[model samples]
Target chain A: MDALTGAWQWLTTAANWAGDKGVWHRLAEHVQISAVCLVLSCLIALPVALWLGHIGKGGALAVNLSNIGRAVPTFAVLVLLTLGPLGSQGEWPTVIALVLFAIPPLLTNAYLGIREADRDAVEAARGMGMSGPQLLLRVELPLAYPLLMTGLRSAAVQIVATATLAAMAGGGGLGRVITAGFGNYDTAQVVAGAVLVAALALAVEGVMVAVDRLCDPMRGRRRAARIGRGPGERRGARDDDAVAIGGAA
Target chain B: MSVPWSLTAAAWPSGQVPADPGGPWLPQAAAPGGADCLVANDWICGAYLRTRSHELLAATVQHLGITAASVALGLLIAFPLALLARRRRAVAGAVLGLTTVLYTIPSLAMFALLTPVFGVSVAVVITGLVLYSLTILVRNILAGLDAVPAEVREAARGMGYGPARMLFGVELPLALPAVVAGIRIATVSTVAMTTIGSVVGFGGLGNLIASGLQGFFKAEVLTASVLCVLLAVAADLLLMAVQRMLTPWTRPRAGSRSGGRRTRATKAVA
Candidate 1:
């Protein structure tokens, strides 16, 4: 309880929120780094994942290869980069490391999203004289939207949490706050930093979920008879669950 | 040219702790002989092989111990929750929701949160790692239970098996593959997460990387990180082998190749 109170005090203290090293400054740095990594990872991963999912060739192999990304520790990558060629290049090393870390879930979820689209609906769209691009942009992409958002949310949260490694590597982020706390043996500061990170993650999750809910027209169907869900939402929450398990890890 | 981190770390002023140096807070500085051999770039691999072989090997064992113990503890917690969720539909929602929320809590934050209560020890590390393993385990466990064909349960009942006996004798074996997959992901992930435990002083191979970073010992950092990746792959493969051994029936007998491999693979994760 004292620890909680102390953490609250540390968080509320105006002095801690001022200056170049303030909590708000650290939070901005954290968000900026995370945004850079998230955009890069999506650009590199999503198109390939979506295309592969569209053509439906080499998918298992592609997913398997991507799984290797999850196995390698991102922190190790940061350390190696910092200790090696990019040691003095500032935040590039951290950015590269985090982009790699964010790739697996983004790629996996996007691929799974498109691939899991209702084959019947896709076939129906094709039969309706829809062209290839039309089928994808019109039919498949909307179906894949919620899942893509979920994947994005998961990746965002992870990158935000991990961008703290930037601080350890002499870059900037909220992790700097905690690591700084550790160096000073300031438990209250460490707890406050953690609270900040946790709150940020949950906030990201909540916003993504809201976006997903709003975009997904199938939201109110659960009570509308199982039949409504069958044709509309193909394996809704369950697909997200599998993504969370397989990709988020 | 890429100068080793030591030069930069040494150049930093002492008062700036973050920039001053980087490494494990708990582990002592490397021995003089070990540090000397690793001072140059070319001799790094040799230094690791000669001096760090034992330390790296010991850290690997400790890493495996911590991961295995955490996963096992995860299983103990997940089973009852899964069982409860299976019996009561209402409880499943709450239980799964709680575990899912717990899963999203990042490892570093988790360590910091638990530090106030548990401090920097194996207890804190394992506890956080176990929470990570829960959603995977519980979901897979439920999915496994849900998958036992309805007719199979009917047949078990016909054979005079009670619900408990039916679960133990009939359902569990069939559920083994999914359960094992959950365990594999959990264990492999825990190995990676254990590296973060170093921040709080309980890191296994992570300590090597940490201390190596502070000392600018390339061999130490590279070896430890490689060992971590290797450990993850090895743990994953080992579980694959165990799954193969346990589910001998899954292997294709002759020419039924198409669905056999893919279904099992998907089912494990699905």
Candidate 2:
């Protein structure tokens, strides 16, 4: 209880929110790093995954490879790059490390999403003499939108969480607050930093959830379908969606 | 790279100290104009492994111990939670929602939040990991239970099987594959997250990697990382094998679709 109050006091301090090393600066650094990594990961991963998922060949191998990537600890990759020649380059090691960490989820989820898009719709589009890109954009992409969003949300959240390691590598982030607090043995500051990070992560999740609902092309159809279903089945379907989001993260 | 002549002459009473023997592929450990001992900074040093074998072993053991305990505990807790959710529609949303929210908490922050209560102990790591595992385990277990064929339950009821007997004998056996799939994912991820425990001073290979990063000790970071990856791969393979052995009926034969469907279902969940 005392520690909680101390953390609150630390968070409330005006002096702590100013200057280069202030809470706002660290939060900006954290968000900036996470955004850069997320964009890089999506750029590198989404096209390949979507193309491969479209062709329906080699996606298995690609997905399996990324699964292996998941087992490679992000911290290990970050430290290895930092200790290697990349160490000489400022923030390059951190950027490269985080991009690598963010790619697997994006790749796996995007590929799976595209591959699992409605086959009947694809057939219907093809029968109507639609071009390949037309079939993909008009038929497949819309169907896959929900899953694609889920992947993006998970990847974004993960990058935000893992960006904290940047502080360990002498880069800037909210993690620096916790590390600095540890340096000074200021438990209050440490707790405050943790609270800030947790809140940021949850806020990110909530925003994505809203975006997912807003952007889904199937929203009306899904809601109508839900209304048609019995209450018990409706709840089961909802649970599965929540579980998928959690699993992706 | 050969040792410089001046330093060699001064250090060795003999005219020259021999430079490191040239290997076609390997870099010289004892590079001149820098740290004298290769083990102190080299990327891959045999000497460091020979000297610190005990320490490496201890860290690896601690890592394995923590991962195993956390996943085991997670499964134990998830089983009941899954059952409770399955019991009613009202309870289902809350259970799944809570676990998902818990799953979103970042590891560094999770530890920091936990430390106030657990005080930098192994308990903090274990508790956090168990919470993390709940999302996967509960979902998979519930999925498995739901997938059990309605006809099978009816047949068991016709034979006078009670709820307890049907769950253990009929439903659980059928659910084993999905349950095991969940375990595999949870265990592999736990192995990776276990390194984060180093922040609290209980991270197994994480401890070595953390310390190594601070001083830029390449061999320690590289070796510990390799071991951590190998451990995750090994755990995944072991669980897959257990799934195979326990659910022989689902095994893929020449024309069997059951195994293929199971694999797809598991992938869909992940």
Candidate 3:
């Protein structure tokens, strides 16, 4: 209780919100790094994943390859980049490490989503004389939207969490607050920094969920019913579960 | 070259370098062994490994132990929660929601939140890891149970099997693959996450990685990171073997690619 009070007091302190090292500055830095990494990751991964998924060739290999990438701890990647030649570059090491860390989920989920899009619908669209790009954009992308959003949500949250390591490498971020607290043995400040990070992560997750709902192409199309009945729906649910499991890790 | 050199110097000023210039923290300084790669900060110095074998072994063991214990405890806890959720649909949403929220919490923040309660100890690390594993384990177990064919359960019930026997003998056997899949993911992710534990001085290989990073000890960082990755892969493969042995009936046909696909999909995450 006292610790909570202390943390609250630390959070409310006016001085803590001022200067270059203050809470607001660190929060902005954390959000900026996370957004940049998320965008870069999506740009780098989604096209390749979607393309391979559309071609229906080499996607499994790509997915499997990315799965192996997941086993490499993000912390290790960040530290390795920092110690290597890139360590001297301003924020490049952090950006590159985070982008690498965020790629696997985006790649795997997007590829799986595209591959798992309603095949019969795709066939019908093709039968109606739709071109390759037309079939993909009109039929596949909408169907794949839910899983793509799942991947984005997972990646976004992960980048926000992992960006704290920036402080460890002498970069600016909310993690700096925690590290500084540790240096000073100020438990209150450490707790306060942690609270801010947790709040930011949750906020990111909430925003992603909102975006997923708002941007779903299948909106107002009785998606619930489509997701409820038929053999196709059952398989879709199972695949979504598998993808959720992927994101959970 | 000059650009990078100046940046490096700016990052580390003179006062930060301790009197013993060649100490673990100052990788570029002159050392007791003037000609050694360890003093020169090579990424794979055999001498460092040869000298620090015991320390390396200890960290590896600690890492392995923490992972095993966390997953095991998580399984024990998740089983009851999964069973409860399966039996009573009312609380299912709450259970899943709580775990998912817990999963989203950054690991560093997770540790900080628990520190007040568990203090600076391995228990704090273990508890956080156990919570993290719940989202995977509970969902997989539930999915595995749900995947059991309805007729199979009906047949078991017709054969005088009670709920307990049906669960233990019939349903669980059928659910083994998914359960094992969950365990594999949890184990591998746990191995990766265990490195984060180093922030609190309890991370197995993480401690070495952290210390190595501070000192810019290339060999230690690279070696520990590689070992951590290897450990994750090895654990995953071992569990895959276990899953296969436990479910021989589900083995893929000679030319079928389904088995490979399922494995890859289940291992979608770390």
Q: How large is the interface RMSD of each prediction?
A: 1.8, 2.0, 1.7
lDDT of 3 at A188: 90
C-alpha-based local distance difference test score of model 1: 0.74
- Model 3 C-alpha lDDT versus the unseen true structure: 0.79
Off by over 4 Å in 2: A225-249, B1-40, B259-270
Q: Which residue pairs does candidate 3 place in steric collision? A: none
Poorly placed runs, candidate 1 (over 4 Å): A217-226, A229-234, A245-249, B1-37, B42-44, B255-270
User: Which ten residues in a row are the worst by lDDT in model 1 chain A?
Assistant: A240-249
Q: Write the per-residue lDDT of candidate 2 for residues A116-232, one digit (tens) a residue.
A: 776877898899999988877888888777667777887777787778866765677898888787667688888998899889989988998898889888878966766775564
CAPRI verdict on model 2?
medium
Query: C-alpha displacement of B257 in model 1, angstroms?
Result: 8.8
Q: Which is the leading candidate under DockQ? A: 3
Q: Write the per-residue lDDT of candidate 3 for residues A55-173, one digit (tens) a residue.
A: 99886676675567668787788889899998898899889977877787788778888898878989999999999999889999888888788888888877887798667666789
Stronger candidate by DockQ (1 vs 2): 1
**Which candidate, 2 or 3, would have the higher lDDT against the true structure?**
3
Against the true two-chain complex, what DockQ does each candidate achieve?
0.53, 0.52, 0.61
Residue-by-residue lDDT tens digits, candidate 1, A1-249: 877999999999999987879998988888888888889988998888888888987677656754586677766777888898888887888888888778777777788788888799899999999998888889888777666776787777678767876666567888888888877878899899889877877776787678777877556753474466665443654664654533332
Candidates by lDDT, descending order: 3, 2, 1
